[model samples]
Target: MIFLLGLALLRGRVGDREAWHCGAVLIHPRYVLTAGHCVRDPNIPNLSLLGVRLGELNLTTNPDCQLGLCSSVVDVGVEQILVHPEYNRACLACHDLALVRLSRAIENLLPQIYPICLPLDPEGELGGSTDALHNSRDWGWIAGWGSVSGDPFNAQLPTVLQKAQVPLTPTPFCDALQQRYPDPSSTLCAGGEGPFTCKGDSGGPLMIDNRMRTRWYVLGITSKGPRVCGAPNTQTLFTNVHHHLSWILSNLRP
Candidate 1:
């Protein structure tokens, strides 16, 4: 569990039936990144983001353990919910980014509790060629406490956190989305063939694991996906993290 894993967003309380609403990625001791929709959604007006559970591996077990190792699940109340200023619920998928400030900082990090590295970019923009993302050799993975059965409409949270490796894909949605909002940045594409993310996976990170460097970099945030998850020839779109580096840096504070 040295890599990225699922963290659950709570609506009101820890065991509340409606707490397992979305996913997030810990980026700092006191901050986590998630979708703007997760922060505030018109469809779920009654449900509010109240807290988050970090280092949670299995839903059925407390102090989740595996292979003779255990993890400490920590719940931190939400101090603030900062949705992207440009995010529009009316548009649904436009600039879907946000940062949630935890009430307190995590003092220590273990194997099950760690932060994903941000992409190594000098300009806060995608330094690698767009073609690199589409290259067949490049690989990425997504993890979450989301639907394990790949059903978008009827999302069933797995007892244990789910993870899958998905290849980067090139899709026409980027162009279509850009045509509508030319000022915004382009998107990252992946996981059309199979093992793609679903509804509850939203706000999770689309990560690139670099074993050679022993560091994990978050490439994108899990954005919108097809109505029928894992549908043949359907690619998923993610919010490119590189595009919002400045915004992320500006808001990262204790």
Candidate 2:
């Protein structure tokens, strides 16, 4: 597990227990992007949402440090959580994203606990267009501190953050999964054979570097996948951010 920046861990209290609920990305100083289900899923109940913890590399230690350097884990309160209106848990398809507005601004934090860049119109083509997404080479970076093993509660959670580079799988790959996987236009599939995300990795970012590798862009948000992650011929599903750019732009507020 390597140190991945711009990743935020959504923490909350569940009936006297503090838990890392889901993953999120810092897009703006005062706004974080996550999955709709993360904010409102009846299956995951009784979670008294607290805030987000940023600039973290390890979860087992306080003030995670390495090579004689340490990070000040910033915990900011959540001012509001806006789940996409079109999101429906029953369908488990499109519109499975959310936006979180922080109680205060995080402009001061940069180059450390900073925010990642959103996709922009490149080469006159719309951002997230089918052409642009495929023009780039395969694979995107996925990082998180989620469970390293089986069922979230029953599995072993990683002490250090985990990172993986998974190739952008095709629509057929997802369709063959035989699950109620959403349409490729709104969702994407990756890591079908092996090295897929496990439970507790939802709402996390699927990132890709710019042409010059100067900046990271959130390509997708971890949504759903097989219960037995890493199973043969199984893949993880992600909500394509490019497909929801309009909704995201209109909802972002400081």
- How high is the CA lDDT of each candidate model? 0.73, 0.76
Can you write out model 2's per-residue Cα lDDT over 109-151, one digit (the tens) per residue? 5546778877666333324453356545577788887777755
Q: Flag regions of model 1 displaced more than 4 Å.
A: 2-17, 89-91, 122-131, 173-180, 211-213
Minimum summed lDDT over a 10-residue window in model 1 is located at 122-131
Count: clashes, candidate 1: 0
RMSD (CA, Å), candidate 1 to true, equals: 3.2
Superposed Cα deviation of residue 41, candidate 2 (Å) = 0.2
Candidate 1 lDDT over 141-198, as tens digits, reads: 8888777666656777776878778878665654554455544454577786668788
The lDDT of model 2 is: 0.76
Candidate 1 clashing pairs, residues 3+ apart or interchain: none
